[model samples]
Target: MRKLFRRQGEQRKIRDKSDLIVKSNGQRNSELEKGINFYAEYLKHLDACSSGASQLSPSDEAHTQNSDLYDGKATFATTQSELLQKLEDAYQRESNLEEKLKEKIKSYQELKEENVSLNKQIESFTTGQTKLAEKHSRDKRALVEEIVELQRRLDGLTPSLALKEAQIARLETEKDTANNQVRNVTNQLQCLQMKLDEARRDEAVISKLDLERRDEMDSLRNSLKRFEIEIEDYKEKERTFAEDLSDLKRALREAELLGKKEKAIAEKALEENSGLIKENSELCAKISLLEIEIAQLNKDNEFRKMNDINLAELAEIRESEKRSKLEVSRLQEKLKAEQERLHNTEAQFDEYRKKEEEVGQWHHRTQKELEGLQTLSSSLSNENKLLRQDKLTLSDRCEELQNKLRKKDEEFERMRDEYETVSEHYRKVLEKLELETALQHERAGEYEDLVNRVHQLSASLSRDDSSSKSSRGKRQTASSENSSGKSTGEEKVQFIVLNLADLPVR
Candidate 1:
């Protein structure tokens, strides 16, 4: 009994420990689930921010146009610098998140290891319970066998003393019935134990699924992190492109203004060149008239040399030709200057065309870049959509698993209740068996006393016969009375056996 009680106490302690472990595991699981949910939500928020940035990117062009060129450039420079700083900050944040994720992974690994250990402990505890149950069953069987043997001995000893064999047979039948009840109860207990083991196995499977889900979540998070980094890189490129576009637009505008000024300067130079050409033609005609007049005067002089004319007129004509030659020289120099100015204007115009071509090329390149960025943004959005779908599917699976786990828990609780009730019934049966054994011992003791009294009466009757043998009649009378008393004693012994046998087994 003391051993049984001690075993019960140990079993209770083990049960309590198991319960504590289970509760702790449950709390840890809940905490892990909460952490996972938090990370999931955070990832969703990041995706939203990325999508919003993509949506707002086109509007930046309109905003850029509204601002003054120089002011926009300055602001763009500052914003680009700030973006660089923010990118750096983002990198730092990503590193921190990675470190945190690593720590979380480590903690999760530790939890997994702890869960495994706990599962092993649970298994060991279950094995111990099974062993204890087997030992109890063995003890009960041994006790039952001992009771059967004791009853057999009582049956043999009391066979000739009274008509009590039928009562003993009935007691033996009752013992057999109790034994069968114990066997049936034990069978039921075993079945319950099997169910409990299966429940535990299911729990282990659920834990495994949880771990797999966590691993998948980690992978998804890593992928999302990579996508975020790529998105940030793309955003930086877009900002740089936008800045370049703004600068190109500014330069193009300045080039256009310069080209217009040069065109006007070229047109004025062309008009001056036309006027200089007409003046040069008029001066050449005047020079030609002078040459003809000079030829006429020379002919007249030749004729006058034969018949004498004034030298003064010829000298005056020579001075007039010299002045005309000087005027022609001045006009020719002015015309040369105008032509040089026209050539310079043409060169400026050529340079302006080259610059315009360069602006067109830059515009084309920027457009292509914007188109590429748009395509990249579209792809990223598609990926985000896919990721969101995956998350939703994972969540649904998790919910289903949770529901299954809840059902398993409910079943486990029900099994535990059944086990407890069965154990209580078994304990009651054991107690009743013990009481029955105790009663059997008392009855055996009373039977031994009756046997001793019978032996003593036989011894006294033998002495009386020996002492009164000479008075034969009186001896016969005394013997008959002794026989009657012995018969009465036998009847009393039978009555006691019947009464003991008639007692209910329960």
Candidate 2:
């Protein structure tokens, strides 16, 4: 148990050391990141400072030279000369520092390689430990196999003991039966004596009794001897059976204990691997985030370049914005025209409704038809939405193009808008022409109804004319009859129209 705790403590120390290494690595990475940032920043500041210093120092040098030109030449030259020397020394110092930083970066790279090597070592060790555990498990399995064999033999012995007990029980029953027979024999003997006393007057009955008693006693003794032999064999088997059973039980217990230990070890190793996997995932995520940050910074630098645009590009972009807007307006007008046409069709549906009622006796069929129409309408509505979405996409594309070309396309957009407006007006006229189609349909329906009425009236007039010729004197003149027929037909049609209030017309 102390050894187990010692191993656990050693493992814990190793875990702690690994944790510390990971933490130190994180700190080092942070320091490296900071160093990179500082290096870049320092370079920026150095460039700015160097430029500023160079510019200012030259001015200072020129000023001193001019002052020396006014003052004593020798004294001014000496002071200017000392100042140049000091500037050169400071510049040399900065250069040396830059070189040192580069060396530090190189050292950081070496440390990174070392860290990778260490990680590889850890992985190999982990694999080695896993192989050991597998070997241990294989050994335990062999032990279990041996234990199983022992159990099977022990199980076989248990049944043998049972069989022996059953045999012993049968032998005991036979012995009891034999003892009863002996008692019966003794009673018979007493009875036989009583009989002999009585049978002394008759000698034949006594002779028969003696033969029967001898045969029964001899059979009872032989049975008892066989039972004794069986008991001895059973006792010997029970002793060996007890020893084998104890051995099998011990082996079974050992196998169970070994299996538990192997499972526990496997669980522990799994936990360690899982922890390592989690750490790796976290590291990968961190690296990805760092890469993303770098990309964002680069993009920002590029974005700043966009601000340096001169005047000409801005004008072109503005102009493109104008032409795209005009095209979008034309498509909007066209969509409006389509929507208006659908509305007019819906209004005409009211007239269809009156006809539907006249045919309303087929109400269920009408309702089913109406459901179909509703479904069609829903489909049309979906199509309309899709068309609208397509229009939106076109508008977005136009806007993006306009934004990109505003500075260069101003004249082009002005001309395009003029053409678009003309096209829009022509498209509206087409919509008006479609609306006129509804009126044409209504007129056609009215003309058909009028023609049908005239036909019916003419048939009635012919029947009246025939009946009059058969019953009365003479036929009327053709022109007068025609005028009379037309007038009467017109009046009858008007009366029919007045009576039928459920007309399908608007």
Candidate 3:
């Protein structure tokens, strides 16, 4: 009996020790698990914070389902202190993450600026066409000066060429005069043979001298007049070249300006988009906090309040008015610039018109040349006409080619617009398809979850139904036995025990 008591005491002591160890082990395990869960929740919260996603707060992280343990126990105090230290570490990590986000924003802005500069370079490349225009302007003035010099030289030379033509005419006249002189000399010599020949010979010499002087004078005057006309025509050609150059330059400048304008606008819009993204992130953060607060306040029955919002905004109105005024001023400046450009264009057009007039002068000069050539030779005039016809054909062909090019450009523009529209529409379709696919996936997951939940509910309902039926059967049996002369209270007590056995413990 003493040995049995001693063994029993030892067993009791072992049991108490084992229970204590097991309880401590279980507490350690629970604490470790809580720490692990908290860490996971912390990580999740950080992720949610980054994306501005709706999530639980730090208090939620520290909270537990076992409020009793928190209220009554100092046992987990060391572990709780460790977790608090971890939370502080997490807060530091969050602060670091915020710094990283700011750096990312700064980096993004820098990249955007770099992209804008690159785009500016691209626009400048597109505007390389303007350089040709500017060259045209310089070339115009140079060509005009060159043409004027050429006209002056032509004028100086024209007199010689005219003089030559006039000399040839004089030669013809001298030939005629020589023949007449020959006839007179022949008559004089014939008559002088019969008489004294000195007076007739002297008269023939005087007539020859007079004829030569008259012929020389006629050649010189004709030469001078022809030279003057040729010089005038050359001057006109110079003016025409200058006009063409100026027109081309103006056109190039306009194209360059347009390219820069469009590029600037695109860059501005991109900046606005970035700003909007930042604002959206801030709004989402605010919204998440509001949602959590609202959820927490939802259970309070005293929160029946309807508040009216007076959205009297001042900054937006002031900013908008400022922008409107700025826009108006910009429009006015643009209009003024446009007017200046218009005047410049008009001046260029006038120069071109002057060039056309110069071309008319060339036409007249060419006509005069043709007339002279026609008078000189029939074959030459026919060849000149052929050359004119060739020039006209070339000009017509150039006009036709230019028209075809313009049409092609317009067609290309239309095709580009259509392609852009198609691409945009395709992009929208892809986005919609992605959204639908996500929705389908979500619906599929929800369906599976619902199916699993239903199976679980069905199983629970079946178990409940079976237990209810069994309890009813036991009660009916107990009642029947009572009717056959059993203790009714005892049977009722037995039925209660059976029902108690069927129920699960909390």
- TM-scores of the candidates are 0.39, 0.18, 0.17
Residue 230 Cα positional deviation in candidate 1, in Å, after optimal superposition: 4.5
Using lDDT as the yardstick, the better of models 1 and 2 is 1
Report, for all candidates in order, the number of backbone clashes.
0, 8, 0
Off by over 4 Å in 3: 1-190, 193-220, 243-262, 277-506
List the lowest-lDDT window of 10 residues for candidate 2: 497-506
Could you tell me the lDDT of residue 342 within candidate 3?
53
Candidate closest to the true structure, highest lDDT: 1
Off by over 4 Å in 2: 1-210, 294-506
**Cα lDDT of model 3 by residue, 1-506, tens digit:** 35444545555654565466557555655766789787677557555644442244545544531343444245346646888886676666556655655665566566556556666766786577588788877876565455435434433443463454354346446545654655665565455343333333434554454455446445544554454454455445444544544554464455446545644654564565456556545555655554554454343212322232222323444455466556556655655665565566556556655655665565566556545544444543454466556556655655665565566556556655655665565565556556655654564464455345434433433343344344546567653532332233223324433433342221
Ranking by lDDT: 1, 2, 3
Model 1 per-residue lDDT at 241: 65
Runs off by more than 4 Å, candidate 1: 1-189, 226-238, 280-309, 352-506
lDDT of 1 by residue, 110-158 (tens): 6566656666777898899999999987976565455435334433545
Single out the weakest 10-residue window by summed lDDT for candidate 3.
301-310
Query: CA lDDT of each candidate?
Result: 0.61, 0.52, 0.51
